[model samples]
Target: MDFARPLPEYLIKRYQGWRATTYSENKGWYRRLADEGQRPRAMVISCCDSRVHVTAIFGADSGEFFIHRNVANLVPPYEPDGDHHGTSAAVEYAVCSLKVSHVIVLGHSGCGGVQGCYDMCEGKAPELEEKTSFVGRWMDILRPGYEALDTGDDSVRVAELEKRAVLVSLENLWTFPFVREAVEGGTLSLHGLWTHIGEGGLEAFDPASKRFMPV
Candidate 1:
């Protein structure tokens, strides 16, 4: 408990500014949301990358999206073995409890997690190959996708792998019984998206073409 400390000076100042401006302007809306509870229409599973702002990209207001962020935006296949499952729990709550209509897996370029995964797979990151490495274990979810990748340049391969991570997550979502039921019952839909961090470009995965099309 002693490890916790007060906010940094800069963060404190930023928070105060937000409270004075944004909070003041949206006071009524904030109060309404607290009273009514969140009824988000979509659930976004995105990377832990600081640059991937799901709400900002969609111009969404508070409570408009149920978002879960994790390394490489991964979703492990359904494995109910009584172990702790953060992503699975989030998906269950979003699809079954909140009844969100859409679940979107959002991947982004220049993702450190994806880079780590690629390096680990290529045997260039021994630190991540240790049995005790949490990142390596979590990234094991992307192994199949990496193995299926077409031969190409390093840059192209990494870019394609980033989008492939989104597809992997989407596929895992289907493994969740609740998600599958919801989708098949016409109550929910799944989508995959990838973004270029530097270019501010986005692409949507087109199932028909099995490709990411510019958005």
Candidate 2:
């Protein structure tokens, strides 16, 4: 536990800088949030990549979003076997407790997790096939997405797989009975988003057209 002792020197300096500037500039907002607690309207499920900043993408203020991040922003099929399910737990709290109106699955290009799933499905990653591997087991949730993708060149396949990750997560979100009930009752909505990092372009999935159109 000693290894987990203190903040790094650089991070400590950064914290001081924030307390002096950013936090100071928003001192009233920060105080109000601390007193009122968070009441985010949306829950954004995104990849764990440092580049996928949910707040920055929306220009969101503090406490505007309840965000959850995983390997590929994946949500596994609903299971209530009294097991550990991090994403599902977040979804449940967001829906049943916080009553977030929208749940967005934010996928992105060049997702390392999606690439790993593609590689695993393509038989290029034998080590990932083992059940003991945490990442392997987690990436397995996207196997169905990969299977449902049409075969093509590596680049095309991976890109499609990235989109599929969003689609599959959206589908899985519905498997949570609470989420489905809320959606059916018109109290909640589901959204899929994909970002092209280098191009700085965004695409939104239209369920009706079954296409990802530029946003």
Candidate 3:
């Protein structure tokens, strides 16, 4: 059953280059982080899209953020039925253990996962409807957001759905008692953000305006 292989040559070469330059130049910083362990100020739940570089967008360095990436960057409502909950576990650790001051949900434009969800919900993607499709099940988390979207052109609907993904996550995040308590106690805050991948533009959700304004 051995299917694993050595690192790809390109990846290895890149690692060697980074180690020779970045790591070498910041050896002390790396060493301190290794010994002191991570104490990030925020937890960022973001999409698995390679283009959405959270660190690069914020110009953050190592140990600055506790990032968790998943399909569409969705967060499920608190369901402690005892099954595997990767996102929930990360949230618990960040809010309870690490005691991060902020929890940020970041969505982006042209998200493949959101696009799939849009198609699945609109009955445009039959493959995603099968009972065995994990993606279909996962994307179910966004159904509420989909249903709430205003009827509009495909492009606008999809783009709005992307922002709704961030909103959905923020809403579900509060369903966790720990997160709610932390927020109520003024120890932690929740934020929603959306980025235009191509434009390199950012927007923040203002609960007051109930809109995403440019950042």
Candidate 4:
């Protein structure tokens, strides 16, 4: 319990600068959010990758989006086993409590999690195949996606699997009764997004088209 450590000097300086400038400039707005509590209309489920900045990418304000990050941006099927389920818990809170109108699953290129799934599926990473590996078990949610992909062309397969990550999460989100009820009642909507990292390009998945289009 005594393993806490100070943040790096650079990050500390960055936080101080934000507090001095950005936070100072938006003090009223910040205080208002604190007073009223957050009622974000949108919930974004994204990867835990450091490169994927949900707020900065969407230019969202402090209380605009309720975001959850996990390896590969996956949403597993609803299982009421009274066990720990972080992503499901977040989704339940967002949909039931927050009443978020929209849920977005965001994926990105060159995702290490997706790549790790690929390696594990292809028998390249033996450690990930072990049952005790947390990441491997978590990444297993995307194993169906890995199997559905055409692995003949290894170069393009990773990118394809990344898109599937978004798709899979969207599909799994519907399995929740609350989500299904909201969607059927026209109260909630699901969106999928895949970003072309380093290229400044974004693609939105069209369910009807079953393809991603530039946004």
User: Across residues 71-173, which tens digit of lDDT does each residue of candidate 3 receive?
Assistant: 9999999999989999999999999999999999999999999999999999999999998999998999999999999998998999999999999999999
* Total backbone collisions for each predicted model: 0, 0, 0, 0
Per-residue lDDT of 144 in model 2 = 93
The lDDT for every candidate, in the order shown, is 0.93, 0.94, 0.97, 0.94
| Candidate 1, 1-215: lDDT as tens digits | 99999889999999999999999999999999999999999999999989999998989999999999999999999999999999999999999899999999999999888888889999999999999999999999998888989998988898888989999999999999999999999999999999888898889999999999999
Residue 174 lDDT, candidate 1, scale 0-100: 90
Model 1, residue 96: distance off in Å is 0.7
Lowest summed lDDT across 10 adjacent residues in model 3 is found at 1-10
TM-score of each: 0.98, 0.98, 0.99, 0.97
Residue 60, candidate 3: Cα error in Å is 0.3
lDDT per residue (tens digit) for residues 28-59 in model 4 = 99999999999998999999999999999989
- Indicate the TM-score of model 4: 0.97
**Candidate 2 TM-score versus the reference:** 0.98
The predictions' CA RMSDs to the true structure, in order, are 0.8, 0.8, 0.7, 1.0
